[model samples]
Target: MSIKITGTGSYIPNVITKNADFHQHEFYNIDGSTFPGDNESTIQKFKAITGIKERRYLDDNLNTSEMAIIAAQKAIEASGIDPETLDYIIVAHNYGDVKFNCHQSDTVPSMATRVKHHLRIKNPSCVGYDVLFGCPGWIEGLIQAQAFIRAGMAKKCLVIGAEALSRVVDKHDRDSMIFSDGAGAAVLESSEEKGGILAHESATYAYNEANYIYFGKSNNAEAPQDLRYIKMNGRKIYEFALVNVPKAMKSCLEKSGKSIKDLKKIFIHQANEKMDDAIIKRFYNLHGLDVPEYVTPMTIQELGNSSVATVPTLLDLVINGEIENQELKDGDVMIFASVGAGMNINAVVYQY
Candidate 1:
């Protein structure tokens, strides 16, 4: 049996924040001290590099699980499957339900459990849980769903990646612009059909631990002395993705016995456009093929990096005709890849 993605859905916050908004605000270093710079030039450079012009942010009253419920409901509706029939719900997220401007977050009941409750799923047999794998969490969840289906442990599963990153981002830090709030979900069901998930690969780099995100007081500028926010070594992550992501994608494609020519499009994580382009070019070069920009669709320019939600959201948009110049057909091969905080990287090859 193979795990088929029967439906896809995504929800992005209605509030749009422009990159230029940060220019009016003062930035702070880790130690709560002010940092001075040409704000306009800095923002310009940021946009030139990341290709992020704006992003969505959930209202202060909302949380990650709520966004996930919206996405999950859409996926279930599209799949024409009853919530009661869902065998499992695997929620992929880094931070749990965190309130805006609040440092405390609660993970006790798990985000998946919260989603199941919000969706009014009454079946006690419908197991729910959360997966924490940095940005690869959703794809990793799909991989697990594939295993469950093959092992006869589940017949249907809801895989979701939701993040309220704005809750954790430090407004005074430049990194805040790269984080946003959104959710994406997919309905995976056991199918006798040959085209579904063909192959997948996942791995971590312990040596790059320093590149991961962590909560700590600002070290560069004084931003209230005790304020803790999401922090990471951006340069390290950029370098790591340039080197590791393509290798993982290549490995996944090889494992599926599919060449780059067989792929219709690659739905890679919407982390950084330049980095993603570089990675894809490197992958094609390794195989002696020219880089094809048309095969790689991107949403980062508008959606920013919604962490794990990036790939699934991009996939949903493209498959539903919401994305310009992109479409997926029956039996078309597609690849999904992501890299994030754990220095974790993963890729999945699927038949659409």
Candidate 2:
């Protein structure tokens, strides 16, 4: 059996955080020292570097699971699939149920479990769980869904990636500018049709610990540590993605027996505009072809980085004609790639 994504959905909170607004608030260096740059120039520099003009954040009352439910509802509605009939719900999130009740974070019941409850999915056998694979979590969830369908263990699965990064990111840290909140979901159904998830590849560079996220106080903090916020060494992550993501995409393409010439669009992780351009350019070079302008569609300029939600949300936008001059026809081949905090990376090929 082949696994096909019958529907796609995404939910971004209504609150817009513009880069220009950051200067109104004070920021701190990683060492907790006062940042010295002028806010206006800093915002301009950030725009030039990341191409992010703004991003959305969940409301105070919302949490990761709730966002996942909203996105899942849309996906089920689009797929015309009854929630009662879903065989599984796989939620991919870096921080599970962050900002629960506007005060705390917890993962005991799993984001998928909470989403299942919210959707009122009555089937006791509709397995629900969460996957933690950094930014590639959603794509990894898709891989698992494909496996279940191929193994005849499940006929349909809802794959969701939701994050409330706004709640977890330290307001004082520079990393806060790039993180956002949102969720994206897809309904994958078993089909006799041959092309859905064609082939995929993933890897982890465990030694690249400096690029990973951790929960702790700043290096220079003297006060009692509060919540552990998202932290990272930007240079390491840039170097890692520049080298590995293209390799993973190329391997996935080779595994799927498809060539660069056969692809339609490449939905890459909305991490950074320049990094994405470089990665795609390198991938094309591997095939001895120039990178096509339209081959990789992007939303990072407006969405920032919501980790795993980036790719699926972009996919939904393209599928529904939300992106200009981008639409998928039946039998079109597409590629998805992401790299992040696990020092983890993944790539998947799909046919629409």
Candidate 3:
């Protein structure tokens, strides 16, 4: 038996927030000092580094769970699976549902429970839960589902990655531009067919890198210390990822017993353009090969970094042919990798 993603779906928010929209906002440094230069120059620099021109925001009337539900519905439809037959529902997220204009996160019910409730699956045996593994959460969830299947604990599982990062961002900080809102989901099941998930690697480096990406007070010094927003030391994260992510990917591929030449595509987390490019380059260098064109697909230019949602959302887009010049075929070997808070890193070697 093999574990495979039977279907995939994603929900891209409708509200478009362009870089030009931030021109009138006051930007500040971590110490509350005014940002150097004008908004135009700042935005240009941001674009040059991150390659983000715009991002999507969840509608004011909806929350992260709702987005997950929508994506889940599409995935279920695509899989032609009965909701009542699902053995597990795993939702990966960071901040729970943060309503528009609200500071508190609603996690009492748990995002997975919320999705199961909304999906209206009535089977009491359909276990549901949540994971908080930073941006790599979805890929981690996939690994978990595969483990469950391998252990004969489940037959079918629904995995989702959803986030409303826009609601948790400190608008006063320039880094805020990197975040947005979105959700993606997939149905994983045990099948007789071959070419499924072959191997995976996961690690957490919290000793000295624990605070690279964190929730901290706003950049504006006057902002309430009691209220915190998503924050990160970009330089630290870039350096850390460059050193570790490629190693993880190489290890995963090696464990799968697949050669570097077998890799058809890499669905990496859309954190930053330059950082991702460098990681891919380094990964190829380790294999004594040049990076192949179109090997790494990205959605960061239009979707920004939606916390845990990036990898799954990008996968859903490519699987559905929404991303141009990218396509997957039978017998194709691919790698899914990501790095984020927890200073966590993970990679999955999959075959389709």
Can you give the TM-score per candidate against the true fold?
0.96, 0.96, 0.99
* Candidate 2: tens digits of C-alpha lDDT, residues 1-352: 6789999999988999999778786777877888777878877887888889999998888888888999999999999988998999999998787663453678989889899998988899999999999999999999988888888899999999998888877677766899888899999998888789899898888874634666666544654486467788777778788888999999999999987899988999999888899899998998899987688888998888999999989998898999887888999999999998777889999988
Q: Which stretches of candidate 1 lie over 4 Å from their true place?
A: 29-36, 219-221
RMSDs, each prediction? 1.5, 1.6, 0.7
TM-score top scorer = 3
The TM-score of predicted model 2 comes to: 0.96
The true-versus-predicted C-alpha distance at residue 53 of model 3, in Å, is 0.4
Candidate 3: how many backbone clashes? 0
lDDT of 1 by residue, 1-352 (tens): 7689998999989999998888886676655566656888878888988899999999888899999999999999989998899999999999999987778887988999999998988999999999999999999999999888889899999999999888888777777888888999999999888889999999988774645667777554534667676887777788888888888999999999987899888889898888888888988887899977579999999899999899889988998899888888898999989988787899999998
Q: Over all chains combined, what TM-score does candidate 1 have? A: 0.96
- Model 1: weakest 10-residue lDDT segment is 216-225
Better of 1 and 3 by lDDT: 3
Of 2 and 3, which scores higher on lDDT? 3
Looking at candidate 1, what is the lDDT of residue 125? 95
- The full ranking of all candidates by TM-score, starting with the best, is 3, 1, 2
Error of 3 at 107 (Å): 0.3
